[model samples]
Target: MSKTIQMPALSPTMEEGTLAKWLVKEGDTVSSGDLLAEIETDKATMEFEAVDEGVVAKILVAEGSEGVKVGTVIAIIAEEGEDVAAAAAGGGAPAPKADPIPAKSEAEAPAAKADVIPAKAPPAAADNRVKASPLARRLAEAKGVDLSAVAGSGPNGRVVKADLEGAAPAAKPATPATAAPAPAASASTPAPVAAAAQDFGIPHEVIKLSGMRKTIARRLTESKQQVPHIYLTVDVQLDKLLKLRSELNAGLASRNVKLSVNDLLIKALGVALIQVPECNVQFAGDQMLAFKRADISVAVSIPGGLITPIVTGADSMGVAAISTAMKDLAARAKDGKLAPQEYQGGTASLSNMGMFGIKQFEAVINPPQGMIMAIGAGDRRPYVVDDSLQIATVMSATGSFDHRAIDGADGARLMKAFKELIENPIGMLA
Candidate 1:
């Protein structure tokens, strides 16, 4: 029998992606675990692999195709001893349904599918079976509409989003007037207004937005509009920390490990979060989550946009280990080869622009994460040492906190702990 291969969902948030390239062509033989193509997800470009051994009979989708939906057949393969021409002419046989990919963390999971409330009315289907697309299901649940009542307009009578338009939700019983009044609904962020297209007649080329760019634009806009931000700044002396880094690098020279200032800062932020647990939290609608361990997400600038690759358990890792891990993560991130788990979940974030000579700037908070620590360049400046003015190496650090979850006092305490750790330079080691 022939087998059909569909486009796989590389990440939990991926709905559609660009088929960047195909490694195998028609009539090529492939085995299990062989690289098949490169898929460009919103976060990264990941390589897809083959699971069955066969000969590539036909390519259903061409390379560089954009907006290819998940579960769409992309290619066909003929089994061993099967006629390639026949398989190609007949298309490919249907493959067995595969299990959905499991999410690595709660934050990465889709809340719409997990928390949907069922409608009160029974489904209209006589056989008690309903066929709908994932998007249609989500919309139906949100609107309290029964899926069986709606007629599908998609392939093979599959319900789609268009079918739910103008559909009313099932009615519920009204509360008694004598009972206590219900709580007011929370305020929602206003939807963005679309701008009218205009051309100034300038001679320029038009470039389409990539998936990564679109995601970045939407996420950052939502973060700024929804999250209430509180900014706190502190100047830390880096002379002692710099000296310690030199000594540690010399000791680890034989191990080929070199520690950057950013590595030490990552450790500091992780330890500080542990010390002041109040700062490590996420604010859900009705509850707050307090984490026991600290996972630091380090921001790396890629070709199209920025991605944060997480350094898990940064508090307990040694400086040398942190350095090694960061080097590998950054290298892979730039090449667009990081897995979803490597960049998905984190207790907090750390963004360093010291290399770009940025003195100080406030960073936008990544949602679900309470705070982000911004590091600035360390340069020579006038400082007060023991009530006397002296020149010292100083850097300005800013912490952007979500006021909904963390209070100003707790944010200050975290900043104090981070400053102490950096100044002493030995407390982190102990």
Candidate 2:
């Protein structure tokens, strides 16, 4: 019997995706666990694997096809020893596979290769009917370049204009035979460059947005428009926290667990949420839901936009544990290798732009998350100590809260608790 392969949802929010590339071709032999293709979802580009062992009969959807809806038939597989041509003609819903592996694992499994967009190979004759934008096709035709021999840079491996100028010379067509011959230049004079087609106008370039970039813009815009935000700002001294971190790191040097300021801040915010439970909440349509355990979403910037990977049960984890977990999450997040659960659903978020020397800024709340704390750079500034002015290292932290879910007093109280945790240092351990 022939088996149909449908486009599986790569993430909980995935509706459509770009078929980035195919790992196998018609008549290829493969095992159940072998990779078949790469799928580009809004969150990441992930590898898709085969669940049923068979011969690759046909590839229905061409590589680089974009906006492929979930469950769309992409390929067919014929059972071993069956004719590949017969299976190519067979059609129906990809019936349930006897393989015990769950369908959810199709997207949830760790990728064998972690790159979001790996270097594309110039298409071959077998893949000549590649998925590409109309513009790219026309440009390829005009340049006497074969679309099959050019690597695509657009979404889902679709060839774009940038590929024309940027593709290796060896991949493009030979220079036009009828063009005017260039005059040889002497050592005193350099040959003049030819004018471009658009030489009459100012130069500009167009950049197509990736799936991840597009989603980031849409979600952040919607959040700002619909969510009523109340922001509270505070300045806290960091000297005590710094001193405590140094002392702790020296004592635990043998463990090889070095805590970052952000890691400690995560612990502080997690503990603060537990102490002031009123602030640990999400805004539902009719009512607010308060959570018992604090799961912190720490924002880490990637190539396209920002992603807040969750630290599950952060309030219960020690600083060393948080450091180790955070490092792993950040590394994987950058590589587009994190699993769905690793980056989804959080009660609150923490965004730190201090690394870029930002003084302070308000962050839009990612809903159903009621709040996000924005951290600024720690810099030296004058402060009052027993009414005597002194210079100290301090940072401005701003908390953006959903007014519908939390009160101003409660928001202020949460900030006060966070301030105390950083300033006193010892309180975070307690």
Candidate 3:
């Protein structure tokens, strides 16, 4: 009997997905655990594996079909010599029908087969291409200059009309016999022709949005529209903390552990969250959740994207352990190999742009997690200490929280406790 292969939930929060690509085709043999397609979910692009082995009898959905809800039958698998027609004809236990997401036509398919060669532009007007701006074309036609003779300053090397009218008139030699030469145009005067518009090379490159990126967009958009968020900002004094970090790094340098301010901040935040559990909370379904353990997500940015890998049970780990775990996670993050557990289940998050020299920033709270802390660059600035004006190391940490899970007062209290832990590094260790 043929079996219906429905789109499975690739991630915990995946409700709908995009069929990124199909590895197998109709009439192709498949196995119980063979990869069927790559599905782009809100979280990541993950492989969709077959659960029952058979020949691919029918394909109902094409690649790049987005918003396919979970359990939608996307394909069928049948035994050898099995009737594919019978399978597709809605016979034998009739598979549930999906509302049918419109599929892309073969001509519009994004994937190119290995044997396919892309068509090259004809070589004319070959060596030079024609690309003219509306104004330039109008001016060129009005001025009676041939656009083809003009070189293109536009993108993809297209000839713009400006290229024609702006062409420098050939410098003529002075002949004494002529009536007083019309006043020679001064070089300093601006030309009547408009300046060339900057060609930002193809308005945009079509990037296939990954599952996580899509999910991030949807979730953030929903958060911004539905969930009310309130932000609280606090300045942290880093003088004593900086000295402590230097001492710790010097002591642990032999152990191949270099402690950064972020590592310390993570440790401190974990401890502070333990003290103020109200901030370590989540609003899901119709219930409110307060977590005791702080699973802090540390945001890491890579070349093509950004991922936040969680340091689970951060409240239970020391600075050295946090540093070591972060090093491994960060390496994997850059290489794009972090396992699901490594990036999920965070009760709170920390996003630091200090090393990049950003003075201040506001962070969006990662959904479900009630709050996220945005850490800014540390700098030496004037401060009032003991009735005297003096320079001191200071950094700003802005906390963004969901009002549904935490109030302004709760946010302030949490930030206050967090500042103390960071200001006195020993307290975090304790």
Q: Give the best candidate by TM-score.
A: 2
Clashing pairs in 3: 41-211, 42-211, 42-212, 43-212, 44-212, 123-126, 131-159
* lDDT of candidates 1 onward, in order: 0.81, 0.78, 0.74
Sliding window of 10 residues with minimal summed lDDT for model 1? 102-111
lDDT of 1 at 233: 96
Q: In lDDT terms, which candidate is top?
A: 1
Candidate 2 lDDT over 344-420, as tens digits, reads 89789999999999999999998879999999999999987658999999999999999988899999999999999
Ten-residue region with minimum lDDT total, candidate 2: 104-113
Candidate 3 vs. truth: CA RMSD? 12.3
* Model 2 CA deviation exceeding 4 Å by range: 91-200
lDDT of 3 at 297: 96
Between prediction 1 and prediction 3, which has the larger lDDT? 1
Each prediction's TM-score against the native? 0.75, 0.76, 0.67
Which 10 consecutive positions of candidate 3 have the poorest summed lDDT? 102-111
lDDT, candidate 2, residue 38? 91
Q: Which stretches of candidate 1 lie over 4 Å from their true place?
A: 91-199
Tens-digit lDDT string for candidate 1 (46-126)? 889999999999877667765677887778899999999888876457632222221211011111222234343434345
